[model samples]
Target: MGYKQRISLLMLIDSLIVLVSVVFSYWLLSPTLYLAPAVVGISSVTLFIGHHIFAHVFKLYKRVWQYASINELLSITTAVSLSIMTLAFVQLLSFQTVYSRTLLVTWMLHILLIGASRFSWRLYRDTKMQSDKNKKRTLIIGAGNGGTLVARQLLNSGTSELYPVAFVDDDVTKRDLTIMGIQVIGNTKDIEKVVVEKNIEHIIIAIPSLIKCELNDIFSKCAVTKVKTQIMPSVEDIMSGRVSVNAIRDVQVEDLLGRAPVKLDNKKIADYLTGKTILVTGAGGSIGSEVCRQVAKFHPKAIILLGHGENSIYSIDMELSTITDGIVIKPEIADVQDKQRIQTLIEKYEPDVVYHAAAHKHVPLMEKNPHEAVKNNVIGTKNVAEAADEAGVTAFVMVSTDKAVNPTSVMGATKRIAEMLVQHMDMISETKFVAVRFGNVLGSRGSVIPLFKKQIEAGGPITVTHPDMTRYFMTIPEASRLVIQAGAIAKGGETFVLDMGEPVKIVDLAKNLIRLSGLTEEDIPIQFTGMRPGEKLFEELLSENEVHSEQIYPMIYRGKTPPVNVNVLYDLIEKSHHLDKGELKDLVLDIAHFKTKYLTQLSLVE
Candidate 1:
C-alpha cells in the first residue's frame, strides 16, 4: 500500500482495538444490566484521543510490522499503558461512577489486542518468506555473540539463499543451547560429521576472536567436509564499527595467521607524524605501502613515496589520495641506490622523518645475485641515510630483517651492512638514525604464504624447504606500526628489534594454508624439497654479540649494533659497482664482518 494509506490503515486498526477494549472492560465491570452508555462513550473517546496523541508522539504508525522486534513490542505496550493510565486518572476525578477495576481490564486488553495486530503481519511474512527446499543448508561455527548475531540477521534478512541449520561451538556449556532457533550441534571436531548428517552446503566461521591455531583446527575439519567456508570480519573491524557480523567474507590466508590484531598507541604515533613531511623509500612494496597508509592516518603534511616501481608507487598514491584529505602525496619514481636521485628528492622535500625500506629481500634470489643485494640493500641504505643526515631529518628509521642477525643468506648480510651504515652515521649526524629489525612479514610480495596458497589453488604438491624449518612472522601492519613506534623512541645508533612472538614451523604454516583453502594435506600434498641455497633452519632476532635493552614501548627493544668501520665501509661501497659478482659478495661480507660466520653455513645446492 502507499505511505499515507498504510498509516491510515494502522490508525484505524488501533482505534478499533481501543474501542473493543473499552466495551469489553465495561461489560466485565457491570454485568447486572445497569450499563451506562454515556459512561462507555466518554471512556472510549478519552482513550482514543489519549492513545492516538501518544502514538503519534512515539511515531508508532511509521514502523513496518512485518519486521517487528522487541523494541517495537515495547513501544506498543508503553503507548497503550500511558493512554489507559490517563483515562484512569480522568475517571477517578470526573467519572467516579465507573469502577476502577474497569480501567485496569481495559489496559491489559488494549495491550494484547494492539500488540497481536502489529505482530500478526510479521508472523505471516516470516512464514511466507522462509522455505526449507532448494535452499543451501548453512552452519555457523560459533555459538557466542557473533554467531548469534549472524543467525539473527540471516533469519530476518529474507533475501539470502543460505539458511542457517545449526551451530558448532566448542564451549561445553553452549553445546545444547539454541540461538535464534538454530541449535548448537557440537564442537568443531564434529564439524565434518555434522555437515554430512545435516547436508550442509555452506559454513560461516563467526568467531571474530578465534586465534590462528584454533582457526586452523576448525578449517581443517571444514576442509575434510568440502563445504564452502566463510568468515566474519576481524574483531578490530567489528569493534571499530567498520563492519558487522553479517559482513561474511571469504577466508583469507592472512586470517590463518591467527595473531591478535596489533593495538598501537594512536595518540603517540599521531603526535610524531602530525604535520610532518615524511619520506618512505620503497613505499610501493608491501611493508612500505602499509607504512604509508598507517602514517596517513596521523594527518601528515606530505608523504613522499619514493620507489623504483612506478606502477606500485602510483597505486599507493592513488589509494591514499582517496582516503586522506589535505595531505600532499608525492610519488617519486627513483631508485634508492641512486645517491644523486635520493639526494635531490631529500633536498627538494626536506622531510622531517625518513623510513628507508627499499631492499632486495628474497633469500634465494639474493644468494644467487649478491651484487644486486649489496647494491640495493647496502648501497641504497647508505644513500638514504646520508641524504637524511644531510637534510638534518629529525628521525631516520631503516627497515631491517631478523636474518641480519647471525646472518646466513646474502640478503641478511647486505641488510646487516645497511644497519651498520645507519648506526655509523648516527654517531656523527644530528639525525637520530636507527634500524628496526623484525622477522618475516606474512603477506609480503615474496612471502611463502602466498606461494602456498597458489600451490593449494593449483591442486598439487605444496613445496617447503625443510619440514623442521621455522621462521618468525608478523602482519605487515604490525611490523609497520612497530617501525613507526621505533622511530618515536629512537635515540641514535640503536638497532630496534620488534618482539615477534614464537617462531612458526614452515610445515605447520603450509598445512594451515592448505586447511584455510578448504583442502587438507592429503588433498594437496606437502613436498619437502630440502633447504635452498643460503636458507637457514631457523631465523634469530638478535645476534649473540648484539646486547639488547627493553624500551618503554611494548614489543620493541634496542640492540647494540657493532661499530661500523666508516672508512672501510665507504671504500667498499665505492668499489662495489666495479667488482665482479664473487668479489662483490666478498666485499659485502667484509663490510659487515660476516664472511667468517656464514662461510661454513652456505649450502649452495638446492
Candidate 2:
C-alpha cells in the first residue's frame, strides 16, 4: 500500500474504534445512552488525539504489521493505555468529574481493537504459510538459539521450501515444549522415530558448536534416514552479511569428516604477518592461493604471487586484488626452479616472509617423471629457500606433504628432500625456516574428492585405488590457515604437523560422496583398481619421533628434524642427472626413505 493510503486507513480505523469504544463505555456506565453526550464527545476527541500522538511516537505507522511480535504488541498497549488515561484527565478538566468505570471499559476496548487490528495481519500470514502443502516438512535438530532462529525465519518466509514441523533437541528440558508454534518432539536418539512419525522430508542441523565426533554421529544418524539433510548457515556468516540465517547449504564431505579446525592465535600471526611484505610461491596452486588469501586477512603490506603458470598467477592476482584494496598484490610468473629468477624476484620484492608451496605432489605422475619431481619439488624448494636466505627473509614456511614422512612414492621422497633443504637452510641462515606437513587437502587439483565427483557425474564405476587405502584429509582453508599459523610459531628446523583426525578409508569416502549426490551404491558401483605404483595403502603424518596429531597441543605439533647428510644429499643431487628412472628412484629412496644411516651403511658395504 502507498504510504499516505496506509496512514489514512489506520487513522480512519482508529477514529471509528475510538468513537465506538467511548459511546459504548458511556452507555454501559450511565443510566441512559444520552446521559453524557458532551462527556462522550470530549472523551472520543481526547482518545483519538492521544492515540495518534503515541502511535506517531512509537512509529506504529512505520511498522511492518505482518511480521509483528511482542514489540508491536507493546507499542499498541502503550498507545491504547495512554489514550485512555488522557481521556480520564480531560474528563476531570471539562466536566469537573471523571467516570472511572467508563474510562476503564473504554481502555479495555481500545487495546483489544487496535492490537487485534495489527496482529491479525501477522496471524493471517502465519496461518496461510503453515498450511502450504508445497513446502517440505522439515525437522530441526537443536532447540537452542540456533534452532529457534532457523524456525522463526522459515516461518516468516512465504516461499521457503521447508516448513518446520518439529524440533529434536538433546536437551531434556526442551522436549515437549513449543517454540514459534513448533514442538520439540524428542531427543537425538529418537531422530529416526521422529522422522517416521512426523513424515519429515528434510532436516536441518542447527548446532554448529557440536564437537566433530558428535557432528559425525548426528550426520550418520541423519544419513541413515535417507532424507535430505543440510547445515544451517553459520551465525558468523549471517552477522557478517555473507549469507542470511535461512541460507542453508547441502552437506559436504568436509562436514562428514567432522574434524575441528585449529584455532589460530591472531595476535601472534599478526605480529609476523600484518603490514609485512609476504611472498607465496606456487601462488596459482590450491594451498598457495589459500595461503595468499589467509595472509591477506592479516592486512599484509603486499603479497607477491610467484608461480610458473600465467593463467593461475593471473587468476589468483585478480582474486586477491579484488579482495585486498590497500595491500599491494604483485603477480610474478616465474618458476621456482629458476634460481636466478627466484633470486631476482625476492630481491625486487624484498619480502619479509616467503611461503614455498611449489612442489610436484601427484604420486603417480611424479613416479613416472622422477627428474621433473626433483627439478620442481627439490630444486624449486632449494632455489626459493636460498633466495629467501640470501635476501634476509624473516621467515620461510615450506608447505610439505604428509607423504614426506617415511616416504614411499617418488613425490613423497622429493617432498622429504624439500623439507630437508629448508631445515638445512635454517641452521646457517639468520632467517627461521620451517616446513608444514599435512595430508590430502580436499578439493585440491588432484585430490580424490574431485575425482570421485567427476566419476559420479559421468554416471558409474567410481574408481578406488584400493578398498583398504586410507589417508588423512583436511579442508584447504584449514591447511592454509595452519600453514600461516605455523609460520607465526616457527622456531627454525621444526616440522609442524596438523592434528588431522583419524584417517578415512578410501572406499568409505567414495560411498559418502555417492550418498551426498543423492545416489545409492546401486547407482554408482565401486571399482577396485589395483594400487597405483609408488602409492601407499595409507599415509603417515609424522615420523616415529614426532607426536601424533591427537597428542599435539593446539593442533600444531613441531618435531626437531635431524640434520641431513650433506654429502649424501649432494651426491643424490649431483648424480641424479645421469641416472635412469629406476636408478634415480632407488637413489632418491635411499636418501629420503632411509636417510643417512642406510646410505652410510651402503657406503661401508661398497
Candidate 3:
C-alpha cells in the first residue's frame, strides 16, 4: 500500500472507533441522566486529537503491523491511555466535573478497538499468506531475535517456499509464547515429536550466534527427525549486506568436525605482510590459493605465484587480479623441485615472505611413488628454502602435515624429513624459517569429502579406508589463515601446529556426509576398505617428545621437534634415486624417526 493511503485508512478507522466507543460508554453509564450532546462531542474530538498526536509521537502507523509483537501492543496501549487522560482533563476544565465512570469505560473500549484494528491487518496477512498448503512446513529452532527474524521473513516473503509452522527453544521461559502467530511448541529435545505432530518437512537452526557445540547439539536433535536442516545466515553477514537475512545455508560436514577458528591478530599480520612481497609456491593448490587470497587482503607489495602446473597458476593469478587492483600479481610456471628455476624466480621477485606449500600429499599415491614424494616434498622444500635464504628473505614458512609426526607412510616420512630440512636451514640461514603443520584439509583437492560426494552422486557404496581410521580435519581457510598467521609470528626453527580440535573417524565423516546429502544409510551404504599402505589408523599433530604446554596464539601451538641430523637428510636426498621404493621408504622412515641413528646405520650409503 502507498504510505499516504495507509496512513489515511488507519486514521479514518481510528476516528470511527473513537466515536463509537465514546457514544457506547455514555449510553451505558448515564442512560437515565441527561446525556448532553456538548459533552459527547467535546469528549470525542479531544480524544481523537490526543490519540493522533500521541500516535505521531510513538510512530504507531510507521510500524509494519503484520510482523508486530509486544512492542506494537505497548505503543497502542500507551497512545489510547494518553488520549483517555486528555479527555478527562478537558472535561474537568470545560464542565467543572468529570464523568469518571463513563470515561473509564470509554478508555477500556478505546484500547480494545484500537489494538484490534491495528493487529487485524497482521491477522489477515498471516491467514492469507499461510493459507498456501504447498509451502514446506518449517520448524524454527530458536525463538529469540534470530528466530523471529526468520519467521517474519518467511511470512512476508512471496519468493520463499518455507512456511514457518512453529518454534522450538530450549529456554523454558519462552514456552507457550506466540510470535507472529506461530507458537513455541516445545524445546529442541522435542524436535522429533514436534516434527511428526506438526508434519514439519524442514528445520532451520535459527540461532546465528550458537557455538559449535550448541549448534551440533541442536542439529543432532533435528537430525533424529531425518528432516533436511539448514542454518540461518550469520548476523554479521546480514549486517554487512553480504547476504539477506533469509539467505540461509545448508549445514555441511565441516561445521560439525572442527572447532571455531582462531581470531587473527590483524595488526601483527599487517606488520609483516602489508606492502611486503610474498612468494607462495604451489599457489594454485587449495591451501596455497587460499593463502594468496588471505595474503591479498593484507595488501602485499607483490605476490609471486609459483607452482609446477601452468593452468592452476594462471587460474589463481587471474582470480587475484580481478579482486584487487594496483597490487602486482606475478605468476611463475616453475617447479619447486627444479633448484635452478626456483632460485631464478627468488632472485627476480625477492619476496619478503615465502610460503612453501608445494608438496605430494596423497598418502597412497606418494607411497607407490616414494621418489615423487622425495622430489617434491623433501627436495622441493630444500630448493625453495635455500633460494629464499640466498635471496635474504625475511620469513620462509614451509607447509607441513600432521602425518609428519611419528611417521608411518612414505608421504609422512618425506614430509617429516622436509620439516627437519627447514628447521636445519633456520639454524644456519639468516632467513626466519618455520614449518606450519596441520592434518587433513576437509575440502582440498582429492580430500575425502569430495570423493564421498562423488560416490554418493554415483549412487553407490561410499568407500572408507577403515572403520576406525581417524584424522584431524580443518577447513582450507582455517588452515591457510593460520599458516599466514604463523608466518607473521615466526621465530626461527619452530613447528607451528594448528589446533584441529579433535580427530574424526572416517566412517563417521562418511555417514554424516551421506545424511547431510539427504540420504539414509539404506539409500547409500558405506563400505570399509582396508587401510592404505602409507595410511595411519589415526594421525597425530605432534609426537610425544614434541608436546608443548602453552599456545603462542589462539588455536596455534609451538611444536619444538628437534631437526634431523643434517647429514642423514642430505643422505636421503642423494641416495633416494638409486634406492627402490621399499628401500626408499625404509630409509626415509628411519631418518624421520631416529634422527641421529642414521650415521650408525650405513645401509643407505651409496
Candidate 4:
C-alpha cells in the first residue's frame, strides 16, 4: 500500500485504542456515576483531532518506518505530549471534570503503546529486509571508523546490493565481538578462510591511512580469494571532504611500488602558475603530458604545447581541451632544435613560463646515435632557453634526469650538457632558468613497469637488464606535479631534484610485478638479459661536489653547482659542433671525466 494509505490506517487504529483505554479508565475511576454518551463521544472526537494535528505538525509521518531511531522516538514523544496537553486544556475550559482526571493518565499509556507498536513494525521490516535471500554477503577488512561508517551506510540503504556479513580486524581484543550487528571474524591473516566460510562476494579495505607497503601486503593476501576487493581513498582525500564511492578506484601500478605520495605547497604553486601563460615543450610525451595536466589545474591564462610529433601533440591537445574548461591550450608543431621556429613561437605566445621537456631520452638509442643526442638534448635545450630569454619569459624550467648528475650514457651526457647550457644561459638572461632533475617515472612509455607488465602478460620469462640494476621511481603525476612546483620556486641557476624514494632493484621489481599479477616465482620465470648499451647499474640525483638543501616542498631539493664560464663553455660547444662524430665522442669523453665524481661511482656500481 502507498505510504499515505498506510499512515492513515495506523492513525485510525491508534485512535480507536486510545478511545477504548479512556473508556476503561472512566469505568474504574467512577463506576457508580456514568457520563452522558454525548459527552464521552465528544471527548473522544476532541482527543483524536488534537493528536492528529500535533502528529502532523511534528512531521511524524515523514519518518522512515524501517530506519526509525532515537530521533524519531523524540518526535513521537513531543507529538504525544502536545496531544495530551491540548485535550486537558479543552476539558478544563468546558468544566468537564465529570469525566475524571484518570482518563488523562490512560491517554499517556495509549501513546506509549501506539508509538511502540509503530517502532516495532519498523524494526521487524528492516530485519526481514536484511535477511532477504538476494542480499550479497560482504566482508569488511577494518573495524575502524571508516569501516563502521561504510557498514552503517550499507545497512541504512535498502536498495544496496551488498550486505555486511562480517569484519576482519588486526586487534585481537576485537575478535569474536560484534559491531553494528556484524561479527568480527579475525585479522587479515584469516581473510581467505573467512571468505570461504561466509561465501563473501566482495571485500572492502576500510583503512584509509594504510601505507602502501601495508596495502601491498594486504592486497597480496586478498588476491588469492575469489571475492572482489576495493579500498577506501586516502585520508587526505577524506579530510578534503570529497569522499564518495566513486573516489574509491581500483588498485593501480603505483600502489604496488610502496612509495609515499609527494606533498606540495598549494599556495606557492598556485601563486606561480595562476593567470600566467605557460608553455610545455614535448607536451605530447609521457612526462610532458602530465605536466600539462598539472599546470592546467592552476588555471593558467594560456598553455602552449610545443612538440614535433603531430599525432602525440593532437592527442594531448584533445585530452587537455576536454579537461580544461576555462584555460586556453594551444598546440604548436615545432622542433626545439630549430632555433628560428622556436624563437618565433615564443615571441608570438610570450609565455610567462616555459617547461623544456623536449629531448631524446632513450639511453640505448642515444648511445647508438650520439650526435643526435647532442642535437636534440643539448642543442634543443639551448635553443629553447635562449628563445625564452629573448621573449622575456618569466621562468624557464628544463626537465632533466638523475643520469644528468653523472655521465655514463650518451643520453646522460647530453642531458648534463643541457643543464650546463641552461646554467650558463641563466647567467646572461633576465629570465629565471632552472633544471628539475629526477629518476625514472613509473608506468611512463618505455618504463620498467609497462615492460614488466607486458612480459608477465606474454607468459613466462620476464626480462631484466641485470640482477643488480636499480633505479629510483616515482609516479608520472607526482613527478609532473613536483616539476610544476619546482618552477614556481625557481631562482636563476638552481637545480631542483626530486627525492625519489629508495631505489628499486630491477630484478626484485620484476618478481614483485609477477607476484602482483597473481603468478608465483615458479610459474613466471625472470631472465636477466645483459645490460643495454649506455645503461648503468645505478643512478644519482646529485654529484659529490654539489651542495644540496631542503626546499619548502618536502619532496623537492635545491642543489648548488659551481658556476661555469659562459663564454668559455659556449666556445667549447661551438668547437665540438664543428668536429666529426669520432672527435665529438672524444670531446664528450674528456668533458665527462671533468664533470663529477658521481660518474666514477656510477661506473663502479655498473
Candidate 5:
C-alpha cells in the first residue's frame, strides 16, 4: 500500500482499539448498573477522538515499525499517555460518574498492545537480516562498549555481510555472559578455538584502547587461525566521535610500533611559522612533504617547495593547493648541490625560515659512492645554510640522523659533517642555524618495513641483515613536527635530539609483519644474512663527549658539539671537490672522526 493509505489504515485500527479499551473499563468498574447505550457511545467517541488526535500530532502512524528504534518506542508511550489524560478529563465533564480505576486499567492495556505490535516487526527484520546465506560468521575481540556497538550495527544493518557469532573478552565476570545475543566464549588465548568451533571466517578487533604488546599477542593468535582480521581506529579517534565502531580497517605496521602519538605545541609552531615565507629543501621526500602539511596549518604567507625530483615536488604542491586558502605555494625544481641556484632562489624569495632536508641517506649506496654523498649531504647542506645566512633568514633548521653519532658508515660521516657545518655557521651568521637529529622513520620511501612487506607478499624468505640488529623508529609526522618545533627554539649551533622511545629489534619486527599479514614464521621464513657493509648493530643518537640539556619543549633536547673552524671546513670542502673516490673517502673519514677499524675496513674494500 501507499504511504498515506497505510497511515490511514493504522489510524482506523488504533480507533477500534481505543473504543474496545474504554468499554471494557466501564463494564469492569460498574457491573451492577445497566450501562446506558448513549453513555457508552459518548465515552467511546471521546476516547477515540482524543487518541487519534494525539497520535496524528506525534506522527506515530508515519513510522515503519519494521525499522523502529527507541525514538519510535518513546513516540508510542507519549501518544498513549496523552490520549488517556484527555479521555479522563472529558469523561468527568460529560458523564455524571468518573471511572478512575477503569481508566488506569485501560491505559496500561493500550500501551502493552501498541508496543507489542511495533516491536514484533522489529524482531522479524533482525532475524531475517541475520539469516542471509552469504553472511560471514564473525568473532569480536572486545565485549565492552566498543564490541556492543559493532554487534548492534551489524545485526541491524540489513545489507551487512557479517554476522557476529561470539565475543572474546578478558574480563572474568563476563566469561559466560551474552551480549546482543552473542556469547562471550573466551579471552584472546581461545581465539583459535573459538574460530574453529564457530567456523568464523572473519575477526574484528573492537578494542581501540589496546596496548601494542596486547594487540601484537592477539594478532598472533588470529594469524594461527588463518582468519581475516581487522581493527578499529584508535581510542582517541573513537571517543572524539570522528569515526564509528563499524568503520573497521586493515591493521598497519604503524599500529604495531607501540609508540603513542606525539603531541605538538601548536602555540610554539604557530609563533615561528605565522606570516612567514618558508622554504623546504626536500619538499618531496617523506619528511619534507609532512613538514609542508604541518606548516600549512599555521597559515604561512607563502611556501617554496624546492627539490630536484619533479614528481615528488608536483605531488606535494597539488596536495597543498587543494587545502590551502591564502598560502602561496611555489614549486621550484632545483638541485640543492648547485650553490648558485640555491643562493639565487634564496635571494629572490627571502624566506623567513629555511628547512634544509635534502641529503643522500642510504648507507650501502653512499659507501659505494662516497663522492656523491659528500657532494649531496655535505656540500648541499653548506650551500643551503650559507644561502640562508646571506639572505638574513629568521631561522634555519637542518635535518640530521642518529647515525651521525660516532659514525661508522659513509652516510653517517657525511651527515655529521653537515651538522658541524650548521654549528659553525651559527657562530658568525646572523641567521639562527640549528639541526634536529633523530633515528629511522617508519615508512619512508626506502625504509625496511615496506621492504619486509614486499618480501612477505612474494611468499618467500624475508631478508634481515642480522638477527640482533635494532634501530630507533618514529612516524614521519612525529619527525616532521619535531623539526618544526626545533626551529621555534633555535638560538644557534645546537643539535636537537628527539626522544625516540625504544629501539625495535629487526627480527621481531619481521615476525610481527608476517603475523599481521595473516601468516606465521613457519609459513614465511626469515633468513639472517651477516651484516652488510656500512651497517651497524645499533645506532647512536649522540657522540661520546656531546653534552645535552633539557629544552622547553617536552620531546626535544639540545646537544653541544665540539666547535669546528669554518675556514678549515671551507678549505676541506674546496680540496675534496678535486679528490678522486679513494682520496675523498679518506678526507671524509678523517674530517668526521671515524674509528680506525671502520676506516681500515673501507680502505681494504677497494
Candidate 6:
C-alpha cells in the first residue's frame, strides 16, 4: 500500500491501544461500575475523532516513512498532546463522566508507547532495506559532521543499497567510537586491515573539506584495498543545505590526481550570451556542439550552427531542436574556409557574436598533415573572423588549446597562428576578436577517456603513452559552457584561458577507470606505449612569456600578449594565396615565432 494508507492503518492501531489502556485504568480506579456505558463510549469516540482531526491538520500521513526524522516525531507528539487536552476539556463538560486522573495518565502513556512503536518500525524497515545478501560492504573514510551526515542519509535513503560496516577516521579519540551503530575501525593506517577483515566492497570518502594532499593520501590507501570508491561533493554544497544521498557519486579519475572543482561566476556568463544571436563555426564537432548546448540554455535570440560535416551538423541540429523548441536553432552545412559562403551566411543571419570552433586538433594526425591543419585552423579562422568583422558582428571568439602555448606540435603551432590572426584582425576591425585556450576535453572523440573505456570494455590491456605522462583535463560540457561564457565577456584582443583543475597522470587515470568499471588493475592491465611524435609529456596553458590577470569571470583569465600589426598581417595573409604547401608551412612556422613577423612579411609581400 501507499505511505498514506499505511499511516492511516497505524493511527487506527494506536487508537485501539489507547482504548485498551483506558479500560485497564478504569478497571483499577473503580471496582464498581460507576461510569455509564454511553458516557464512556462517547469519550472514546471523541478521542479518536480529535486525533484524526489533529493528525490531518499536522500532515502526519504525508511524511515518507524511510526519510522520517526527529522533527516528524516532535510533530506527532504535539498533535497527540493537543488531542489529549481537547479530550480532557470534553470529559469536564460531560456530567455523567467518571473523570479519573488515572485514566488520563494512562492515555498519555499509551500515546508515547504508540508513537515510539511506529518510529521504531520505520527505522527497522530502513535498516532491513540495506540487508540485501549481495550488497556491497562499504567503509566510510571520515568521521566528521559531513561523514555522519552521509551515514545518516545512506541509512535512510533505502536506495543505492550500500551497507556501511565501519568508519576510518584519523582522529585518535574517535578511533574506538561507534557512529550510527557502525564502529570506527581505526585511523588511515588501518585501511588495509579493515578492508581485508571486513571484506569491504567499496570505500566511500566522506571528507568533503579535505585538502588535495589528504585526498591523494586517502586515494592511495583505497588503491591498496583494490575496492571501488566514491566521494562526497564539496562542503559548500553540503552547507548550502542541498546535499543528499544522490550527491555522493563515483570518484572520478580527476579526484585521485588531487584536482579540485573549478569555481565559476554565473552572473558574468549570463550577462554576455543572454538575448544575443550567436553563430558557432564547426557546430557539429565536439567542442562546437558543447558550445551550442550551453548557449541554448542562456536563452540566446538565435544560434546558427555552421559546419562542413553534414552528418555532424544534422545530429546536433536534431538534438538541439528537441531541447530548444522556443529558441531559434538554425543549422548550415558550410566550411569556414569558404570565405564567400561564410560571408554570405554571416550577412544573411546578422549574428551578434561568432565562435570559430572548427579546427584540426589532433597532434599526430596534424603533424603528418600540417598543410591541412594550417588550411583549416589557420586559414579557416581568418575567413570566419574577417567575415564576422565585415558583417558587423560584435564579438568573434576562437576556440584554442594549451598546445598553442610554446608549441612543439603542428596542431599547437597552427592554433597559435590562428590566435595571432585573430589578434591581428582585432586591431583594425570593428568586431571584438577573442581567443579561449585550454587543455584536453575529457570524453570527446580523439580524447584518451573514450579510448581507454573502449579498450577496458574489450577485456584487454589499457594503453598509456608513458607511466609519467600527464595532461590537463576538463569535461566537454564544462569546457564548452565556459567557452560560451568567455565569449560573451570578451571586450577585444583578449585570450581567455580557462582554469583546468589539475594535471592527471595518464597511468593513474587508466587504473581508476578500471576500478570504476567494477574491475581490478590485474584484470585490466595497463601497457606503457611510448609517446607519439610531436606529443609532449605535459601540457601548459600559458607560456613563460605570457602574464595573466583575473577577468570579470572567475573561471576565465585574460592573457597579456603583444599585439600583431594589422596592415602587415593582412598583406602577408593575402600573399599566402600564391605559396605552395611546403612554402606555406615554412611561412606559417616563421610567422608564428615572431611577435610582428606577420606584419613585416605582409608589408614586404604586398
Comparison by lDDT, 1 against 3, better one: 3
Question: On residues 194-267, what C-alpha lDDT tens digit does candidate 6 reach at each position?
Answer: 99999899788999888655787887788777788889986756665666634888776555545455554566
User: Across residues 455-491, which tens digit of lDDT does each residue of candidate 3 receive?
Assistant: 9999969998788999889889889988999988998
Which has the higher TM-score value, candidate number 2 or candidate number 3?
2
Q: Evaluated with TM-score, which candidate comes out highest?
A: 2
Give the candidates in order of TM-score, highest first: 2, 5, 1, 3, 6, 4
Candidate 6 runs further than 4 Å off: 1-12, 33-72, 95-101, 116-120, 123-132, 141-160, 167-198, 206-217, 232-248, 254-265, 499-502, 518-520, 548-555, 560-587, 595-606
Residue pairs in clash, model 5: none
lDDT by residue (1-606, candidate 4, tens digit) is: 898898888787768766876666656675543365655565577778877788789877666767776777788878877776776777777765534466566566766776787788777866786778797888988898878878877777777777888999998998999987799989999999999999988788888888888898998788778456777787866775667732445566577677777776788889989999999999999999999988988899999999999999999999999989889989999998899999999999999999988889888887778788888987799889988988999999999999887778788888887887788778888999999888898877778788788778888689988889999888888889878888888878888887777888888778767756767777889888899987889999999877465554677778867655545445566676687766676566545545443344323310
Candidate with better TM-score, 3 vs 4: 3
**Candidate 3 — what's its lDDT?**
0.88
- Higher-TM-score candidate of 4 and 5: 5
Residue lDDT tens for model 5, 296-346: 999999999999999999999999999899999999999999999999999
**What's the lDDT for all of these models?**
0.84, 0.86, 0.88, 0.80, 0.85, 0.79
Rank by lDDT, descending?
Answer: 3, 2, 5, 1, 4, 6
What's the lDDT for residue 438 in model 5? 89
Angstrom error of the Cα, residue 588, model 2: value is: 1.0
Better of 1 and 2 by TM-score: 2
Q: Pull out the clashing pairs in model 6.
A: 572-602
Give the TM-scores of the predictions, in the order they appear.
0.88, 0.95, 0.86, 0.82, 0.89, 0.84
Winner on TM-score between 5 and 6 is: 5
What is the overall TM-score of model 6 with all chains considered together? 0.84
Error of 5 at 441 (Å): 1.4
Model 2 stretches astray by more than 4 angstroms: 31-33, 235-245, 546-553, 595-598, 601-606
Better of 3 and 5 by lDDT: 3
